[model samples]
Target: MLKTMHRPFHVSPWHLTLACGLFKLLLAAAAFALPLSQVDDLPRLVGLLLLAGGFSELLLSWTGRHSWVGRITFGSGALTVVLGALFIGGPWKGLYPLGPFVTVWFLLRALLSIDVAFQSRLTPMANWIWLLLRGFVDLALGLLLLAGAPLAMLAIVVFGEVREFVTLFSATLAVSFAIAGGGLVAIALTQRHYHRSDPFMIAS
Candidate 1:
């Protein structure tokens, strides 16, 4: 006799994990496959990937339903959507614009992943180390973007003279996505519980 005005939505944690995993893999693939030869196309491709991440984050927001984490994710997802569009704009060409955005986006999600991975301390996940590793990697990338990248990278992003730098960035991006994505997929495949559920309201 579950009677309520609002229908409750039940969500599968594994499903969310799967969706996210697939998305991360796709992003990685796109990053690796992008036509780096054509510098003009890099911004657009990067924008598209960012948009994908935003969309995926939006979808994943449901997993956090009714929780602070969910609310934060929802907000960040919205911002990502806008930023993705901005990146796609022709004015924001080159790595300069995308670098900062990517850094922030990765850092935000990295912390989230680390926070959730802590659940393993109590729940004990066999592959929990991977999650921690992912977080550390993400943190490193963000820090690099903030300061680790050579100061001249800004000039390189603008002039496109240092093809090597761009190559390195793309490579790093691809690796990050691969590892993070794989972790998500593994988490989903192994998860055995439903995080939440939506039930139809029975009018009594």
Candidate 2:
């Protein structure tokens, strides 16, 4: 019987989720710690954050490749990666407007969070409610940026207080990322508990 028995090692998917969550938290901390003197580097920071998030999404898509969730995750990840590359590659001062770029970023992120929340409902994942709330928070932040971006740009142009605008933008991104990271960490911990109780339970 011992010769016939086999045990295969299986790494839990939540491990990746946990790592990604912790990474995002670190990113959030970095963003929050940015000083006013380094405001000029905000674009690069944003680009890096986008790249990190995009890669995480791409990896996550593998967990559900045959489902609609996977398709959306892949698409979102691709777009985010492209946008992040663009932001990092060029100065973008004369190429395009920052308002629209930021608006789209926030919107895409919001949609992804909302999609994840809905998908979580189909799984044994805990903290689906928190994911839903996080989605709404992302949505609200995106909408607020969409509505106020033009006004903010106008103010920047009139007053030439570019630093102030960058400051506010950085702060907003920091808070959003922090919330998202925290939510992920919480969900990952809960999923770990569930997994321990039942080895069959998996979180995607």
Candidate 3:
């Protein structure tokens, strides 16, 4: 009397990726919605929020598409997670946190642009130049933050140094979250379509 074994359900990568993307977007919303700025330990509170965002990013990386695109995505996510951990442990407080956070965001975004480029290649006559250009720009921004000179100048021009550059940093985070979230969802949909068409493609 042999018993049949039941296999546990496995989540599709696209599903998990979209969920993580949505969660990341929500983290940005939470960061903005909460009035933690007025509190005494802004760094600790903000650090916690960033930690949550980082965790989602790590999860996204884990569930992202399986390819070189995914590898770069994972590296980007891991780097941001490390920065969040550093912020929580000590240092990376106040204005110092902004640079690393923004830089990491741009770097992650650049990797995502690579993913977009990879996807575009599958389409006919795809204008991958746009995606590559965006990736270059994002990479430049991250490098500039490391340079410290240009980022400061850009920050001053965009949001000014007043009010601790809070507006500037938050805006950066917001844009990163928004773009990544939307892109991940769109990519997930595309992947789903591809999966659905696989059998037909094979038969053809």
Rank all candidate structures by their lDDT, best first, as comma-separated numbers: 1, 2, 3
lDDT of 1 at 119: 43
Which candidate, 1 or 2, has the higher lDDT? 1
By TM-score, the better pick of 2 and 3 is 2
Ranking by TM-score: 2, 1, 3
Q: How many backbone clashes does candidate 2 have?
A: 0
lDDT of 3 by residue, 28-76 (tens): 6765643436433555666676677667766665533354444555666
Compared with the true structure, all predictions reach lDDT values of 0.67, 0.65, 0.57
The model with the greater TM-score, 1 or 2, is: 2
Each candidate structure's TM-score, on Cα atoms with residue i matched to residue i, is 0.72, 0.77, 0.64
Query: How well does candidate 1 match the true structure in TM-score terms?
Result: 0.72
Clashes of each: 8, 0, 0
Return the top candidate by lDDT: 1
- Poorly placed runs, candidate 1 (over 4 Å): 1-13, 35-37, 72-76, 124-128, 154-161, 192-204
